[model samples]
Target: MEFNITESIQILTKTPSVISNLLKDLPETWIKTNEGVDTWSPYDVVGHLIHGEKTDWIPRALIILGENEDKAFVPFDRFAQLKNSSSRTLKQLLAEFEELRTENIQKLQALSIDEQTLERKGIHPEFGEVTLKQLLATWVVHDLGHINQITRVMAKNYKIEVGPWTKYLAILRDKK
Candidate 1:
């Protein structure tokens, strides 16, 4: 599929609502449950997404546009949400994610990026040079990845109970 900026933005903008619709009002036990010792819970996933909204996506885009490969983007702290989300409730995190995402999308739109700008290059600390288009595409996929992760983790709570039906459910069968 073509990477239409408008469609990408639509997917990016809808993430918070999708997350809230799936997670809001759930029991704390359910929201905080993990598939295993090291995996993230639904709450943790939301916090991690909040961290990305605050630190990763737009900041990296700005670096790409402003530096134009002159400066390498900083390595992201993938676990920032662990410390940063300690004090906030799931509701607070959701609200913050929505607000930050909206603000970032507005900033992105304000950049007035065109085809040439989308082709602009930035240095990634780990991946070396990458295009603005690649970065934006990653941002969209990143959100979807987390949404799928949250769903899988939640579903696994029923893995044992589902028993015979696990054969039909890829989420239950695919345990990492």
Candidate 2:
């Protein structure tokens, strides 16, 4: 698949703003509901994404740019990072997350065309020898996936379920 950097960057640019706005309207307490649930609260979710961009995402991007195909992918401890992300306010965490995302896009923009196209080689613990473009694509997909997760969590927390027909409509939408 052709990687449209412009489109990807646009998506990357909007996500944090969108997420930030979502949080801004929410009550601060809502960001940390159901603490012991298997799923993360909204705060934890954003924190995880922040940790991901700083540690996993940026490092992988650098490794790809550096053309270190033989290197192993680094593992990140997201939960631990989230726990230690400070006892700051939810708004502060949201802002920190957006700042990190902005940094990621800046780094992405600085990549030369050649660097972006370079054949990345990394040994994933499960899937080996992945390409740079593939990793970039995965990063975009990861953003959307988490947003979807957040939507689901929001719906669940509100005890609002789409009807059977709505679920069918979603499946049909995916077909397109």
Candidate 3:
């Protein structure tokens, strides 16, 4: 489907509530399990999302919109949440994510970005040049990818219990 800013915002706005509903008040077994080493649990993913809210999305958007001649964005630390989130509860991270997402959506609306603005370019450290539209789309997809990751981690919690039925469940069978 084509990228619609309004449509994108719909998914973006719903992510916090979706995550909260899925994991809130659940037992530690569900909230804290990971696929394996180097994989993030639901709580960890929430912290990562919070980190992105604070440092990635809006900051990069502003760099794209700034008056500076050089449009290069600062490199993003993909794992900053590992350290930062160690001290915070999942509830705190969820609340902060919701607040930041709401504020950001409002700010995006206030910017009054149009077709021309979406086409504006910025420099990515690894990807070279990219457009505002691509960046915004990435923000939406990034949230979704983490959500999927969280669910996959949770499903794997039942990997052994499911036994033969695991063959029917792609989420459990797909070891990646």
Best model per lDDT: 3
TM-score (all chains, Cα) for each model: 0.96, 0.80, 0.97
Model 2 alpha-carbon miss at residue 148, Å = 1.2
lDDT of 3 by residue, 86-147 (tens): 88777888889899999988888788888999999999999999999999999999999988
Off by over 4 Å in 2: 34-36, 67-70, 114-118, 160-176
Per-residue lDDT tens digits for candidate 2, residues 7-106, read 8789888889877877776875666663254667777778788888878866876775675445777776758645766486778777888888898889
Model 3: what TM-score?
Answer: 0.97
List the global CA lDDT of all models: 0.89, 0.71, 0.89
Off by over 4 Å in 3: none
Candidate 1 local lDDT, 1-176, one digit each (tens): 96789999999999999999999999998899987777899999999998888788889889888845365787888888889998889999999999999999999999888999999888888889988999999999999999999999889888899889888999887765
Provide the RMSD of all predictions against the true structure, rounded to 1 decimal: 1.3, 4.3, 0.9
Ranking by lDDT: 3, 1, 2
Superposed Cα RMSD, model 1: 1.3
Question: What TM-score does candidate 2 reach?
Answer: 0.80
lDDT: which is higher, 1 or 3?
3
